[model samples]
Target: MTAITKGAPRAFVLLRSRRRLDLLDPDPEAWTDEDLAGGLSRTMRWGGASQWEHPLSVAQHSLTVLAIREADGALTAGEGLRELLHDATEFMLGWDCITPLKAQLGEPFRALEARLQTAIDARYRLPRWTPEDYALHKRADRLAAASEAMHVVGWSRVEMRKTLGIAETPLVHDPLSPCAFAPWEPWPPRVAERLFLERFHALDHAHRSELRKLEPELRSSLVLTGAEHAAS
Candidate 1:
């Protein structure tokens, strides 16, 4: 590990991969993909509340969002990767605070999360979200939250709208049901970790393939720009 500058703030956590992450100043390469998958699988959503055998995990929630987006239409590899990692920072922080709670945590907490998210984005080379894309992502995220609240967290439709402040109707059919797990059932940590890693690797492969396909065009564009510069 690189030496921390004297007097600089540091909060370190040992990862499952036997790597240390400095939470105050995170190094994107310090944690492996497996570390992220394991952390996410253990990070509970809905403040760890559950109506079933286990609390819903951020890993499962991420897959749910990706599935929802896939159900909408075919997605580019980048889009799929974005959906899969939208909340990845929560895994590193070891907390998935509810929206209302996040507000209460104030700007300092938000800044910390933002720093961590920046690191995650760098690590994954995630695409930036356009306004329309961000709106779509939020819609899917809310839909997943609504469905999980109703089926997994035991919130009624009325309560979802009133108490949870979710206006979207919960999805009747779980998007991930096709995976052979019970509908809306939260998988155990080990199962969630395995599934999350599988999806991540698949998406990563496709994303890299797409990037490779674009490389020749990118080189041509760069060469054209250089010629134009010389002619000017």
Candidate 2:
């Protein structure tokens, strides 16, 4: 009849029901772009781990990746959405620490989770990822990782070696701290959803203008393929 978490309904997190008292749940629709921003700075270490910052979560990371791609001039609405939903699968599968992202969690798990992410995108009327989309997202993600690693994830290289008995690499600092530029605080999810939706329109217009700048065959191939779908 009902699922419970720590003697309450697990309305936010569906999978935590069995925990019986873990009321922790994340509101999906309430996930404003802020909640989904700035995750690219994360990493999948040899022993990958997941960490959250003050009012900032991994979901935040996804949004940042999208923003980076957009700033780089991804004019396509689908392209923008694709980057935002790159890790959409994690919402269903649970956030994996680096240990899991690597072999520890296994390939099947990642593949299945990835498929689910694609399905979620489709459900939301977002297109699937193309090769360039994946490459672009990964590049942003890696850069994000290096940035976050330096900002968060405590332990300097010397400390890591002395305490954990592990080798460490040097990472440059991000000029901005996690707190300086947050996407979520004052604005609610409704506002973020609206902003992104508007950007979808803007991106569509930009996409077309970009195509006209492409090579003749590249531009012509679009006309031959699903022009109507591509237009949007």
Candidate 3:
């Protein structure tokens, strides 16, 4: 990885030589889909899960986000492209959970990640760190995170009060189903991949119209989520 200060700014570049993802290599011109599958498949190991979630993969969570977004309306091919790259850097930087990273790793990983992301952008011909994309993706990512915390992880308003030390009601309007944590909740690895493609094909062009617009009231409900699930 190399950093060139050609412009008046000091941007980073970590993956100067890495290959762009090939999920759609055979048909790079195919229809769009929600955030990247591989990115979400990212594991919760290395302190990735919050206390409420059951070690759900980022890929799974991304699917949920895509599903919810599709339920709203149609998104464009470009919007789908944007969503897919939202977490693309995870392929290289790995999912560094928020608290641990801010308190421990700090700026170094972020610096490298910024570089890797640049390479991803250049390779994919997508927009770079523009303010609009930043805001849009952050909203979806955070909303997805919060939804996973409250819905999938099984955290409660009381638990949130006791542990996270927040008096807020949490993003969930209700509690998790008893079956939510069942082993059956998570799909088998291969099935998960197939499901991602399935949903992508299913939602084709249905979510394009609302690409850049999201309801503030709706996303406001999602909050960060996680938990340490003890394997039985």
Per lDDT, the best of the predicted structures is 1
How does candidate 1 score on lDDT?
0.92
Question: Distance (Å) between predicted and true CA of 77, model 2?
Answer: 1.4
- 37-127, model 3: which lDDT tens digit per residue? 4434544432544443345664555565554454456655555655655555554444645554555777876665666666655545553
Q: What is the C-alpha local distance difference test score of each model?
A: 0.92, 0.47, 0.48
lDDT of 1 by residue, 115-142 (tens): 9989988888788999999999999999
Model 3 superposed RMSD (Cα): 15.5
Off by over 4 Å in 3: 1-42, 45-54, 71-73, 94-96, 128-133, 161-184, 197-232
Highest TM-score model number = 1
Task: Give the residue spans of candidate 1 off by over 4 A.
Answer: 178-180, 227-232
Give the residue spans of candidate 2 off by over 4 A.
Answer: 1-55, 99-101, 155-232
Q: How much lDDT does candidate 3 score?
A: 0.48
> Candidate 1 or 3, higher lDDT?
1
